[model samples]
Structure formats: structure tokens, C-alpha cells
Target chain A: MGETVIALAGNPNVGKSTVFNGLTGMKQHTGNWAGKTVANASGHFKSGKRSYTLVDIPGTYSLTAHSPEEEIARNFICFDKPDGVVVVCDATCLERNMNLVLQTLEITENVVVCINLMDEAKKKGIDINLALISERLGVPVVGTHARKKKSLAALVDAIDGLPHGKEVCRTDYPREIEEAVKIIEKKIPEDCEVSRRWLALRLLDGDLSFKSEIFEREGKALNHLQIRRAVSEAKMYLDKSGIPAENVGKIIASRLVEKAHEICDGAVTGETGYYKTDRRIDKIMTGRITAFPVMLLMLAAIFWLTVKGANYPSQLLSDFLFGLQDDLSGILTKLNAPSWLHDCIVFGVYRVLAWVISVMLPPMAIFFPLFTLLEDSGFLPRIAYNLDRPFSLCNACGKQALTMCMGFGCNAVGVTGCRIIDSPRERLLAVLTNSLVPCNGKFPTLILLISIFFAGSLFSSLTSALILTAVIVMGVLATFFATKLLSETLLKGKSSSFILELPPYRRPQLAKTLVRSVFDRTLFVLGRAAAVAAPAGLVIWLAANITVGGATLLQHCSDFLDPFAKLMGLDGVILTAFILGFPANEIVLPIILMAYGAMGTLPDLGSTAEIGTALAANGWTKATAVCVILFSLMHFPCSTTLITVKKETGSLKYTLVAAILPTLMGIIACVIAAEVMRVTGFC
Target chain B: MNEYISLNQIKKGEAVTAVRVSGSSSTVRRLTDMGLVENSIIECVGRSPTGDPAAYLISGAVIAIRSADAQNIKVRRRENG
Candidate 1:
């Protein structure tokens, strides 16, 4: 099944992933390539009578590597020697994607040009003459709508069809470089399978990367005496032509662009001013006057939908799960299991697990799909583009806007999304501040506080939403503050080059997106929550049940922390709850209620009124409520996010900063809020 | 050459032919690879809300680049536009 590995390669946003998924379906494994952090996915699928494994390489704009992503992409095609490469190109913008395609073609003639998104191209009144492109590239070219399964028949046939390593239209360099190539082309080793002329071009380009990559791939350097002499002679000849060696890389790239321009002329027609519809929409989207309001409205609408939509599903899920708790206890009793064992599994682990799942699932289920739709519709980049100036002021870029938006769903996902930020400085800053934005897990807690203290039942529902939006704004502001603070002190650097491509907007595929978002984002986050929920549940159960001296362990810990918590205008129980709630924010209120002796067990407090009653009985005034909300908004990210930071940054130092930065800010904020309330006698 | 202004200096909706792009090796190389080479017709399609970065239509791709980097590219008014 692993035989005949074919590489699926393309530029970013070209729907290469769609083609890969259609070919591989669910039978795929994502693994690291050459120790790089980018996803390297490969899958096995059968075509007619043949079974082939396809590896989807990292999407790169060019084969001459700059970033790690580009490096992985170039190294794979140059060294991995897959049976064939299918370069997926967006039909609407074929010329831009051709750099990678043409580069792949130069490396090896075993290529199939997959012109994807044919439907989008037609909508733009663009026509592609497939035969002309096929003839020009001397490779089998197939056009298809990657989303529709039936349209892929020709593509699959091409994958199964090609052994045609016909002569390719080589990327012609300027006279100086061409003369250099001629000096060395015939000296290339015949046994080496890479195109000889391409090898000569790379050597003349002074590509040091290929030498090391060759050493790793072939276990030796290209030390052929004749080849070495020819390489030097080519360099000597190039020097005689008065072309500076420093400009060789740029010259080679410019020549490749020119060649791609030459190939696209006439073969693709009616492409001028193609994105008229998208341009009109983008005007309002990025319009100076309308941009910020539209962004905020879109955000609030998504949050509103998530909160309202999750209500019914969350109730049903919790009811079903809590119902199973009784059956589980009964089974334990029937088995004559020890009383302690039954209580540990039932009250301790099972209860917390059920609580986190019910609270986290419904909202994420609604939120992630909506977020994915925004991303799929291509509006998310506009958010980055519009916000770039603000972020650059913080020594970051607008890409962090994307990560911050994801933080609204889950901080861990946001932390992971920071990988897209190219600079290590900005990435770390983004990761460290991601938790400042309240995630969906904390939304329930924040809403409960707002409902009880700020937006009491006297206020309309809109007031509560406005208050909640204000809280999110505070978190976003806190993120910027922390980011600026870190940039000035810890991660000081000028911002890197910020380049974003806003792809043509297309209708999002609703069905596939729903299924994929549900599985990939919803379940993935839920799974991480459950991982810590089980263990943290046991510890919280132990703290509540195991008595130290007279009171329970939970009570003693709360009493000890009461003085410090008082400085922040919160009681000890509130602070202790936050500490324990490091696993999942949803259970924080329940733990506080349990510690307050308001309920004998962790009651999934049925309503905001119920939770409010418990807090009011425990002496939670407006100051306390404000502090608690602020803390939840700014506290250390949950255990799940910390682990992700540790994995992503692979540095304990950065992960520690990620955990401590927001917590320190939260503590400072609460302390100030509490003192102001006391001094002003606002209570 | 002095007659040509930097790309970032162009007004939105203006079209220019790139004379050359000069920057750090990485930036210039990447720009060229994305088809911002010599003589390529570049059009400033839209400016971001804050006006620090602008979207340019280069060879049919809408690329958003910050003004800091765009300042490195030299361009002149398109003769044929």
C-alpha cells in the first residue's frame, strides 16, 4: 500500500488540501518532514487496479526556500523522488501558482498539472485551454473542480496515466546566467537523476542549501572533479559578464516569473479584471469607514449565534450525561465495588468530565464551523490585512489578529495558530498573550457573573450581550498591553515582512465544512479538555472530600489564600477555584459552590439564578463579581494551552512566560480594581 | 531612475510599471518570485483601513504588503495605462 508514493504539491490557498482529501479520503497519516513543524500528510488510495500512496507536501510559493515551509517543500521534491508530482494550481489565478509548478517541472519531468477550482475560473469569465498548457509544459494537464467528486475522474486518470517525461520548457535565465549554465550543464553526473540543467542552474545560483541536502540524501557531496571544475568555470564566466554574484538569486527568480508570464499568455483568456465581484465586496470589507464596524458586527453576531444556539444542545447533553451517572453508580453497587472506589469514579472523575464536555462542546461545535466558514470564504485574511498596522505597533503583525480570533474559541488552538507568524519573537508574543481573550470555555462563567451583578434581570438581553462584548474588548486590550510589554522587555525585535494574499472569495462548501469542522476543531478541543478534566476532576474531588483537621482540604486551601485574594477584592474560595479550574474554566463556579458548602456535591448549577444565589450567600458583592470576571478573563491559560505552548515553542522558558504573563497582568488588574472600590466606597 | 517613486508612494487606484524592487535579499527574492519583477504592471487596488499596508494586483494575484516593504520597490506611471 505504501508503494508508488506520489507527491501532491501546490501553492497555499490553491485547494491542494481539497484534492488531497478527495483522493485519500480518511486514510491519511500526518507526520513531520525532516524535523520541521509544518504538517506533512500522506495517504494511500487505490486507482482502478493500482494502489498508490500520495504525500501532500507543504505548500510553497517557490522552490528556492526562504521559510522553513518552503525549505521542506523544496527538499522533498529535490530529494524524496516521489513517483510523480501533481502540481495543483488555482484555475482562476494560474500564473501565480506556476512558480512552484514550473520549479517542480524543472526538478523532474514526472509532473501532472492539476488545474483546480475550474468552477471559480468560469465564474470570472476565464477560460483555460488545457491542451495548449499540456502541450507547452509537455506534461499531462487536467482541469477539475476539486470539491465535486465526479469532476476528478480526469485528474485521477492522469495520475494513473503519466510516464511522459517529455522535454519541458526550461526556465530561461538572462544571457549571463544562461551562459553560466551552458558552461556546466554537460559536466553534470549522468547517474544523478535530477535534471542536469536544473542542477547547473542551482549551482550557479550559489545555492548552499542543495549541497547539504545532497549530503543528507545521498550520503555524499557532489565532489566529481569534472563537475567541480565546470562549476568554478561557470562562476568565472559569469563574473566576466559583469553580473554581480549577489544578484544571481534575484535574477534567477525574475527569469522564472518572466517564463511563467510567457506560458500563460493566450492559453488562459479573459483573466483581466477578473475579480470584479470580489473587489466590490472587499471594498466594503476593507473600506476605511466601514471596516472596523463591520468586523465588530460580524464578531458579535458569531458570538451571539454561538451563545443562543448552544443552549438547547448543552441542556440535552448534560441531562443525558448526568442521567448516566445514576446508572453508573447502580452498576458499581451491583458489582459490590468498594464505596470509596465508587465515589472516586462517580463523584470525582465522572462528574467533572461530564461538566466540562457539556459546557465546552455545544459552543465550540457552533463557533468553530462559523469561524471555518469565515476562513473558507476568505474574509479572515482581510481581518489580518486591516489590522496589520495596529499589530505592527505592538511589534507583531495582523496575523496575530487571526490567532486572537481563534483564542475566542480556545486558547490552545490560538496558540497553535501562532505558528503562521513567521518571526519567533512575534509567535512567542502571540502565544504568551492568547489567553487574555476569554475563550468559549470561560464565556459561561463570564456570562453568569454579568447576568447576576452587571446585567441583572432588570436589563434587557441586549444589555447583557453589550456587557459581554465589553468584557471581550477588555481582554483584547489586555492582550495588546501584554504584547507591547513583552516586546519592550522580553521579545524585542522589529516586525518581520508581513505579506498576505487575499484569495478570490468563493462560496464555502457547507456540507463538507460542517463535517470537517465538527471533527477537526470541535472534537479536537473537546478531547484536550477531557484529557485534563479527568485528572483535575479527581484532584478537586479529593480536595472537597478529604478533610484536613476539621474542615475539608478545599476549605483549608481557600482560607489560606483568603488574604491574598482579598487584595484583589475576591474571597479565598474564588481564588482557589481559579487555581483548580486551571484544567477547565467551566467547573470553576461549581468548585467554588462546593467549597462554600452551598451544595453537598458539584451541582451543575442549573441556571444563572442558582449560581447567583450560591455566590450571594457566599458574600460575593459587586466588587467580588467584577474581580472574578476579570480574573477569568486574564488568568493563566488552562493546562491544555500550556501543554500546547510547551509543544509548539519547544522551550520551557517561553511556556513559562506564556503561563505567567497573563496571570501576572490579571493579578495586577484585580488588585487595582479592588483598591479603587474600597477607597471610593463604591460598595 | 530618480523620476520613479517608491511603490508605497503611489495613490490607491494608480497603475505603475515596476522599474526595480530593492530590499533585503529575502524580501526582494520573494517579491520577484511572486511576479513583481522588472517591467511588471502593478496596480494599487485597495488600501487597508489604517493605510499602513495596501493590496496590489500583481499579475492577477491580489497581494497585501506593508508599506515598509513596499517602499523598497521603485515604479513609474504606466506608459500605456
Candidate 2:
């Protein structure tokens, strides 16, 4: 009677979110699933005076409770009980995608199968008989190119007709399993939401979640111990019949595969030309010897392009903003504004915003578009495939590598990307360790230090860029090592199985990639950094000016942290600025500038010599520079990351570990660097 | 015979059944969540591009499985008749 609840379910990378966006526009909040941080995205749409709430369930392959996403998806479908469910499947990968459809069919009869990416499937010469699939599944099947908004009207019509439709009856498993299912069905309580046949098969497979949920729902009517006994009995019976309970589900799947193969054999006919091309590409991309080098070269090129291409725009933006600031300041002075008010407005707020825009925006605008191009071209998943092994050594799922890759853009997005890692333990491990991968926020610090201290006279910019790349590599290595250490010690467990599909490379739509990247990533970074930087600007202003005794608040804080900073091969000012810049890493350099009376703008490092002179004035030795690099590389994450960690792990203990682990590592690494420098007399 | 047994133990080129996933619902859901259903035939395809653990082809999808996780998975060899 109210808003129609339309549940959107799909296999990963089927462009379900694209459809949600197409329908609901950009008004969506990407947050943790109800209780977990596995990224539940929901939005609303109104079609023909009937408002609809679209819930995007995590893309899962099946309804097996082997991973958290599956469990959440299963619970939402079976319990939360939406008005209708739209199962979006990749038309190109129909057979594989149908596994989820088959599983969903067993659960609820109210389903609309939206075969997405029809255009891509057509490009591949794969012709799907949507009517046949619809008739076979016994549900309304709508073939759609979600990106093009094809057949959207039909999809809506199907959803509207869901309430009055007759129950769709699809084929069942072999008679033996069906017989066993019937027996188990009789045992199950009628009020249980899931189908008895599905429950029976699950029980035989030793699905504890299904059994637990049944017991919880049935209460005293079905004892927990009794349910366990019944499940055990089902397993034993299946085993004695020469079919292991575990193998039962697989047998059914293989049978379905055989049927699907038969259907495709006649329903679709295509040349092997495309398949050959796929093999040829896979040969080089996924090859044993060539893959790693190729991946590194690709990453290096990406970073090089980002840095080289961004330089002009970054300088242009900086010059423009600062030039405006000068004009505004002159206007304020002419208007007889008070000195403090003028300083706070011009030097404080305006300066900080300029730094964020100049330093953060250009790289983001360049990097995000490049990253999105790779993602759309289907190269990103290959990156995951390439990195999965190193990731596995750390007792983490390979998908964490993808999340870590996302971390390069922003850690919040990276943490959210942990949805790809299905295991809660592994996902948590990924989320907690993701901050070790330096985000864009930390890029300016790394870039500034490298440009100022490390790059020599000749090929200075090139050397600085290389140093930044090396720092990123170090951060990634640390993430892997930390994940491995944590998995082995504190969270000792097996990493869950992750099947990452390398989708076929498509031509990335330039316009769409640019628009989405600008809106989604560039603006997101600016908005978040601006929110934190505004108050941070005021705070830094107050700290620099507010004097305790003869020294300012900034001096007092630095002096307080001086002893610890000295031991860690850094000065008090660096540590104090890091602490103050916790809200946003974009302001750390500004805070440092404010401390040194440089008016909190990019210090005029016109030449390498000038940068050297500035460092000399700031009491930074070569050893101090090395320590700053290491500390920045290993330090505790910014406040945003800390809050994300708290939200994802949902335990003060894990959050503490996440924070303390990185902090301790940073201190220890810095101290070690200081000692090495002292002993070697590098200082 | 030893190759089969060792393969049964834990190594690349061995076939294994996903006996049970022993991690949290999040972990299990991720695997099963992605359609790696119980009883799906999983074959170790090759080592990762970095060559630590191995990758496997499961249910028409390629999944990377670490040695540590692989060791926990119990498999019964498909008898050659």
C-alpha cells in the first residue's frame, strides 16, 4: 500500500549499481549493511506515481552461507521479505549467473530476472532466448542493457504485476534428492520462510545458519539439539546412499550445468574467434613470467601519467586561488577589517582551501579518470588476479588487493571496497590493514618530502616521482606483511575462497568515465577534506596565535611531543603537526608552514636549492628527512581512517589494535632508522 | 599415488572439494556469496601472478586460494574407474 519495496540482487560486476543509479539517480548512501560494514547501498525511485524503495543486496553467486555476503543476502531475501526481487544477471555469462537465479528461485517465487548487459552479450555474439529463460525459470525475464535503459519499462511492469502472479515452478533436482527433500520438508515448520525443499538440501549439506534460523523461528516447537540431530541424520542418510551430503549440492549444480550447456548448444551458436582472442590476451596478461613485470610497468605508467599530467593543472589552480586570495585580502584591508578577522578569513580559511584544491584536486581528477578507465576496460580485476598470491601469504583473501588498490584513491572508499572480501575475518583484516596503503591524502606529504629532500639537482622531478612510487610500494608491502602477521597471530584463520572473474576488456566510455570520476571521486575527496579542513584551519590559526606565556599554543604542543619525536628520528614540530592534522592529512604541511611563519601556503620551493635552504632553516638533517619519510609511510592512519576502522570492525578492541599496531610500527621503524643513522654517522 | 596423496594434502595441481569454510559468516558469505556453492568442482589452476598461493577455477570463475586456507580444505580424490 505504501512504497513498493523492490529488492535488487545480482552477481558481482553485473552493473546492478549502475541500474540502481539509473533508476534512483545519484541520491544514495553507500554504508555498511544493517549491522556489518559490508557496504549496503539503498536508494529510492518513483515510477508512475508508485514510489519504490530499491535495496541493492551484495552480489553473491549463490545462497550458500559460506561467506557473510551470502548470509546477509539469504537473510534479507528469506526474512526481511521484500515485495519483489530483481535478479540482475550478466547476459554474457548466463549459465554461471543462473546459479544465483536458481538458488533465488528455490527461496522465493516473486522474482524478476533482469538479464543485464545484453549489448555486451550481443557484441560477443551470444544470443540468449530471454523467453526460454523466463519459461524455464518460471518467472518474468527481462533482457536489459541497464546502461542504455533498454527494456526498463518491461522491468517496471513485471515488478508491478508481482503481487497477483501465479507461483513460478522451475525444475527440481533428481528424484532421490527430491524425495529426501520432501521428508525434510515435512520436518520443517510451516511458518519458516524458506522453501522446505531448499531447507532440506541445506540441512543435508550441514548448513548451520539455516538450521539455527529454523530453530530460532520455531522456538520450543523445535529444540536446537533436535534440529542438529535431524541435520546429522540427513547427512548420514545421504552418505550411506553413496552421495556425501556435501556433494549433493555439487551434483545438482553439475546437472544444472549440463542442462545449461544443452540449452546453449542449440539456443546460441557462435564462432570461436572471440574465445581465441580472450585466450591470446590471457596468455600475456595472466602469463607466469610476464604478469608481474607487466603489472608493475602498468602501475608505474599510471602514476607517471597522474604526476606528469597533473602538474600543470595543479599549478594553475594554485596560482588562481592564491591570486584571488591576494585580491580579497587587499579588499578586506581597504574595508578597515580587524587584523585577526582579516588573517582568519584570508590566511586561515582561504589558504587551507587553496592548498586542498591545488594539491589534492589535480591529482584526483587525473588519477580517478585513469583508474575508472582501467576499471571499465576490465583491467582492474586482472590487477587483483596478479596481486592475489602475495595477498594470500598474509592469510587474506586476494580481493583485499583490489581494496588496497582502491585505497590509493581514498581509504574510506577502500574500506568500503572490503565488500569484495567475503569472509568477515578476512574482510575485517583487509579493512584494518587497508590504511597501511597510503591514501591520496598522504600523497602530498610524501611528494613534498621526496621533492624537497631526496631529489638531487639533475632530473629532480623524475627522481621525486620515483621516490613517491617507492613509498607507495613500501606501504603496499607493509599492508601485506601486517595482514599476514595479524592473521597468523591475533586473528589466526584460513582466508576464504575468492573467485575473481576477469571480465572481457571493453572500450571505456571517455565521457562517462570523466563525469563519474569527477563527481564520485574528485568531488568526494574535496567535500570530505573541505569539511575537516575548515575547522582545522580555524584550530591551526588559533594554535599559532594563542600564546601560553611567551610561546604560542603550537609551540607548546610541539615542545610537549619533543622527547618522543626525538627518539623516533623526527622533530617535535613534525609530530605535533601530524597530531594536529589528524582530522585531515591535507593540512599537515599547512600546519607546519603556520608553525614556521610561512603564511601557511605552499612554501616557495622554486628550485631544489631553495627547498634545501628551507629545510636547513627548519633544522632538518638528511637523517631527519629519512625518518620523516619512514614515519609518514608507517604512521597511524588519519582520523577518517580510524573512524572507518571503528565502524567496520565494530569493536573497540579491534579498532585499538588497528590504531595501536600502526602507531607502534611507525615509532619502532622511526627509532630504528634514527639508530642506524646515528651508528653509521649519516646524521 | 604419492602425487595424488600429496595433491590431496595441499599443493598446486590438486583437486579439492570445499568441505567447509570455518571462518565468520562474512568470509563464508563471500565465497558462497559469490556463487562458489558447496560441491562445485574446484581445480587449482596455477600459482598467482606473484607465485605465492595458487589460483583455482571454480564454477566457471577463477578464485585465488592461499596455501594456509588450502591446507584446511579436505578433499576426497575422484576415483578413476
Candidate 3:
């Protein structure tokens, strides 16, 4: 037999990707707990002697083309015509998932229903009769706990055992609707890849996407005007039969749901006890009085753990990595290496790499897993559920709340996560505002500034945590304000409504989640930062060392930027460091220290007090520190995030806006702050 | 004659049967696809503290719908209790 192509189809949160991973053994990051998968990923696996290629499409509630994900799934199934489609359903919620299964059956004849998450169902006292369901639906059905390899073998066997050229049992619409579809079916070209009845039903239900899809597939062979005429005739006939024009789709949907109910009545039995536990948890987590406080406390705890926990490890890594620098310098001296080469390699590139890794790795190691834990445990959607009203008030979708949480981890990832929002305008608003939240790279700088400048000797940790939390809260509030402003002016539109499903809260697989996050997110992000930091370090070293007219190039650049930087309550070196730190935010302080010429290498200031002394010697004051913090929180994203924004939006216009928006906000904020402090004599 | 009320009017823990799921075609279809068809048993599970989007238990799924969207789904209190 030839290679069989099987498309994995399902509603969101159905463990479809788990089944794919089980069969293919490829780790494609599954959807967020809310069931939003942005991209289509494919993997190849072998079942017996026949090789099977599996395409993982984005999950959607229906194939009506209300959203982009739904459109992609619909078009791929209609046009690509995979050999057999595997419709995976969550055993606990078979009826809700069966809607997509019936829709897929309409599009293709070959299908096998893989009931996934059987263990979760069994634990919840839910029993699904697989053979009964298969007999009723007239399709092959297999049960599997997708997370375990042993259980998926049966599903693999079912895939290879699918029969071809059999009659497909499709959902039976009402008599009048079936007659309308019959009329429209005769108009569809016979040579089309999709089934004529499916096209007829979609067209009569007022879905025009298939027309364009057919045109794209078959150029000018099908008459568009004839199809439009036939669709109008079908709608008029339905209206004449006492059904309202707009209610055609509703009538069709209800009929399909009735079929689903009939099949579910005989094939499924469950107590639904799991929902009580989920609801009890939701009551407290989303309780109005408790929700805001719980969110705040969670935020504070994560940051506290990150800040306090990362300090010792950061110090250890710094000591270990920098300790090697001395040994390398000793070898260079003994071998009589050139001084410039020694300075460039050791002081420039190597020091920046050490600094970036030591600072970035520790916090990322703590933050990503915590974020993933929330995501996996499904609390992230509840957070979205709580924040939806506020986001709706701002004329944006509520899913922006989840995307904003992603921003707290890394702005680039957050920007990409905007795909969760189905509306274009709101997604753009999210992409533009994501960088307001400080990412892992900016955390160290913000924490250092808060510690040395705001927190004194007594109660240092507490004061630092409180101030950092306040800064984050301010960034979040700023994001809301900017989203509102952008919506009211640049992207004026009504907020699109969504049916946000609060998936049953499940016990997070902590060990697997941590392992996946560490490899997929933390290491991946750290690798990107290191890639840029090395070259950036070389440039910084050259600019500092290269003399031009009795002053190094770094001195000349800083002198040139001094007047403007001073006007904004900063020195030329701070502005120059920020400009250089575009490659990676982790290297900003090292660049500043290098420019100060306090030592030939990045300094190891032991305590906040020592760091304060060094900055005080460099003409820093309280006003400067405050401006620096504000600037750090509001500056352009690092080079990696900018490139990501470019790639995600695919528009230079928005990418430029993403870069300029935050910098302008930072400059305006810093200027206003400086003016206020200067006039009030507060600093 | 039977009294009909929209889903938004139902109190928490009150059971009702859907009489009509109405809205734009897409919204109505989405509601039905979520198993909100006529005669399906539904109960108001809980309301968010702000109380705009309320969770409803329909066909064993807890779906949160805003008040505006919930207004489109009409229901009647269960009888013969």
C-alpha cells in the first residue's frame, strides 16, 4: 500500500496532539489549556508495514469558518482530501466533541474515532461503549489513553485497518433543508475534490468560503455566478418553507446535535463528579472578592521565588564562569598572545556570554516552569475568564489576558501568543502592547535598580519584592490604557465575542511539564540571547577600545548622546548602553560598567551597597535611578523580540510601530517623571 | 401557554430547557454545536463576581457566556417536577 495520510481532527482540549505525539513521537507543543493551536504541524510514523503521515490541524468548535483556525481546518479537509481522518474525542465530553466528528464525516468518507483520555474518563466514573458508538455512527472506533504508549497501539491498528469506498453516514438535516441541499448539490461541478453534498450544505447555510476555495483549486472551470444564483434560490426556497433565512444554519446545527445526543445516550454513561471539584475550585479562584487578591498573590509569589531563589544560583554561576576567565588570561600571558585579542576574546565576548547566561538562565529556569504549570493546570483560562470583562470594556478580546501573562515570561513569546485572539484588530493591539511587560532579560536590571536605589539596608528583600511588584502592576495598567487608546483611535472595532470553555481542571503532569518547558522554552530562549550577546560583546569591546581623536569610540558616542540623555535625567553612557543592549537586555549593565572604565572587565560588585557606591561615583542619583527603571520598563524590545514581531505580524508597518511605540512611551514617561521630580525637588 | 424567559434571567442552580437559541447565524450555530439545542437540559451553574459572563452547565459542559450573548438563548423553567 502507498503512504497513507491521516489528518488528526478534534475540538480543543481533546488530547489530539497527545495521540499525535504517541504515534509519531514528535514533541509538538500542544495548545494552551484553552485549546488554541496557531499552527499546523505534521509528523510521519509507521503503522505495521504501511507508513502513515499525520497532520495536526488547529482545533476548532465547528467547520463553519467563523474564525481563521476553523477556516484552515475546513479548507484542508475539503481540498487536501487526506486518505483517512482520525477524529479524536475526549471520552469525558464525547457529545461536545462529536460535533466536529460529524462535520469531518461530512467532508470525508474515511474516518476512525479515537476516544482519547480514557483514563481520565474512567477515573471520573465515565464509561464509553466504543463498539456501540462505532455501530451507531457506522465508523470504526478505538479507545486509547493517549499519554501512554501501550494504549495507543490499538489506535494505530485501527488507523491501518480503515476500509475504503464504503458509504459514509452523514448527519441528516430536516426534510426541507435536505431538499434545498439537493437543489444546490446539482450545481456543484462534478470534478471538485470535496463532496457535492457538503458543498451544497455549506453554501445553503451561507458559508461562501467554499466558493473561493473551489475557485482556487479549479481555475475558472466552475461558474461563480451560477453557484451564487443556486445558493440564493436554495435560501429563498427555505425561506418560503417558513424557515427564516438566518435560521438555516441554526436548524442544520440543531439536527446534527440531535444525532449526537442520540448516539451519546446509548454509548456513554457518567456521573460527572469531576465538575463539582472543578466548580468548587473555580468558585474561589474566580470569586470576585478572592479573584483579584489571588491573582496578585500568585504574581508576588512567583516573582518572589524567582528573585530570592535565583540570587544564589546566579552568584554561583557568575563565580564559576568568571573564574575560568582568569585561567584563560593566564594562558594568554604565558603564550604571549596579543593584548587586543586577549581583551576582545576574554573581556568582551566571554564576559558578556557569562553575564547573560548567569543572569538570564536562573530566572528563566524558575519563571517558564511556573508559567507552564499555570498553563497546564488550566488556571490561565480562568484568569482570562476573570479579565474578559475588563478587556471587553476596552474593545478588545478577553484572550488578551492570557497573552499578557505570556508577555511576563518573554515579550516575543507573548506577541506570538496573540494568535489566541481570533479578531485581527485585537491581536494587533496585543502585539503592539506586549513589550510593556518586563521580560526575563529586563528583570535583573529592574530588580537591581529597585534594590540599590529604593530598598535600603533594613527589610531589603521585602522592600525589593514590593517595589518590583508595584512596577509590574504599573506595566499591566499601562498595557490596558494603551490598548484602550489604540482601540478608540487606530483600530476601532467592536470586541468579538467567544464561547470560552472552562475546561475541567486536571492534575498537572508536573514532571513532564517541567522537562518540556526547560528544553522547549528556557533553553531555546537562552540560546537565542547567547547567539546575539556574543557578537554584541565584541562590538562593545571594540567601541570601548578603539581610539578616535584621543578618545575611544565609546567615549565619543556617549559624549554625543550626553545632552539629550541628560535632558531625560540620564547620562550619555546610560543611553549608549541601552542602545547597545538592543541585542539582548541582559548585557545593559555590563556595557554600562565597561563604559565607566572602573575596571577592564565586567565588575563583580558584591552587594547592593557596593553597586550603589560605584553608581554614585559615576554621578548617579535617585532621579537617575528612577528614570532608568522607567526607561527599562518602557524601552524597545530586544532584537529577538523585534524580529519575532516582524515575522508574526508580517508587516513592517506594525513591526516599526511595535519598536517605536514603547520607546516613545518610555521617553515621554521619563521626561514627565524627570520634570515632576526636578520641579518638586523630590529627588 | 407557557412562559418563556431568556437564559440571562435564570438564577444560579436553576434548571431550564432551551426553547430557542437565537442570534447571528454563526453565534446561533456555535451555541447549538455546544449542545444548546431546543429541549436540552441546562442549569445556571455560577456567575462570575462581576456577573457579566455566567457559567451554564449544558450537555455536561461548563461554558461561560456573557449576558449579551446569553440573551439570545431563550429558555423555560422545567415543569412536572
The TM-score that candidate 2 achieves is 0.85
Query: Which segments of candidate 1 are over 4 A away from where they belong?
Result: A27-38, A179-200, A206-219, A223-236, A458-461, A584-587, A597-600, A681-683
Model 2 is docked with a DockQ of 0.26
Residue A431, model 2, lDDT? 83
lDDT tens per residue, model 3, B1-81: 669999999998888998888776656767776778988888888877688778888877788888888898889899741
Stretch of 10 with least lDDT, candidate 1 chain A? A27-36
Query: Interface RMSD computed for candidate 3 is what?
Result: 1.7
Q: After TM-score superposition, what is the CA distance of residue A120 in candidate 2 from its true location, in Å?
A: 2.6
Better of 1 and 2 by lDDT: 1
DockQ measured for candidate 1: 0.76
Greater TM-score among 1 and 3 belongs to 3
RMSD of each: 3.4, 4.9, 2.5
Docking class of 2: acceptable
Tens digit per residue, CA lDDT, model 1, B1-81: 338999999988889999988988877877877778999899999999899799999988888899999999999987655
